[model samples]
Target: MELENVIDAAVEEVLGLAQGWLGWDGRPVVFDGNAWTPHKSLRRVTDHLVDHLAEIMCRLNGLDPLPDHWHGRTVTTHADFARFTETDLEEATSRLTRLALMYRAGLRGLDPAVLDARPDPDTWTLREVVEHVAGVVYYARAMS
Candidate 1:
């Protein structure tokens, strides 16, 4: 899928999860007996998309991923999910779009061979995951 499509899907999916299956607090889908935390839940959702973007960059370079830690986990506390308003959502979306645009630009400007070159093993590269959740939304104004 195209980058815009991927981003849109991520946003829609997150909103749906937040409004429906997952509460504002990021509770686990399983309510019967699960430890749900709101902050962590939000982080989980955010990290999912970030990881996808990272994977895309990694695949372009033909590198194996480091073992991931949160492959499977259960919700446990309010700190996991936290709380945010609709405005926060809008801002975040905007920031992501902006960052995505920049990424696109950088991708376009790269040499064909260098685009896929791997960075030094111990050095961080552009594809390294960033924890700035609202980056694109904040600077790019892509959020709606």
Candidate 2:
């Protein structure tokens, strides 16, 4: 799929999820025998999406992906993953919306050649990852 289509799909899906899950009080939205509390602030999830989009943006500009190891770490415990404050939610939504708009603009201005070019041999090209995120966003919704 085109990068723009992928990005648009992801944004729509995430916004829809956010609308539905806005009332969530950080309970375990999923627990299929495995002990994991998947529920989190919409802020957390929005922040994550923005971070990954930034990674894509950097990769598109021929830069290395920065290690945001903090995001990769697990929550301290079930209790620690509680609901976010109204302020936190507001900030996250603002940042995420800005990031999403930037992604859309970037997609509009990107050259086809740039999208086709591979950034690394072992990794996916920038375009591939953009589409991959669209797929992953769906998975994120299901698992959330």
The best candidate by lDDT is 2
lDDT of each: 0.45, 0.59
Backbone steric clashes in candidate 2, count: 0
On a 0 to 1 TM-score scale, where does candidate 1 land against the true structure?
Answer: 0.45
In model 2, the clashing pairs are none
Best by TM-score: 2
Give the alpha carbon lDDT tens digit for every residue of 10-110 in model 1.
45445544343222443333432444443344455455545645654665567766556664335454454455557655655565455455445435545
Residue 118, candidate 2: Cα error in Å is 1.4
Find the 10 residues in a row with the least total lDDT in model 2. 31-40
**Which segments of model 1 are wrong by more than 4 Å?**
1-4, 16-38, 75-78, 95-144
In candidate 2, which residue ranges exceed 4 Å CA deviation? 31-44, 68-80, 84-92
Candidate 2, position 112, lDDT: 81
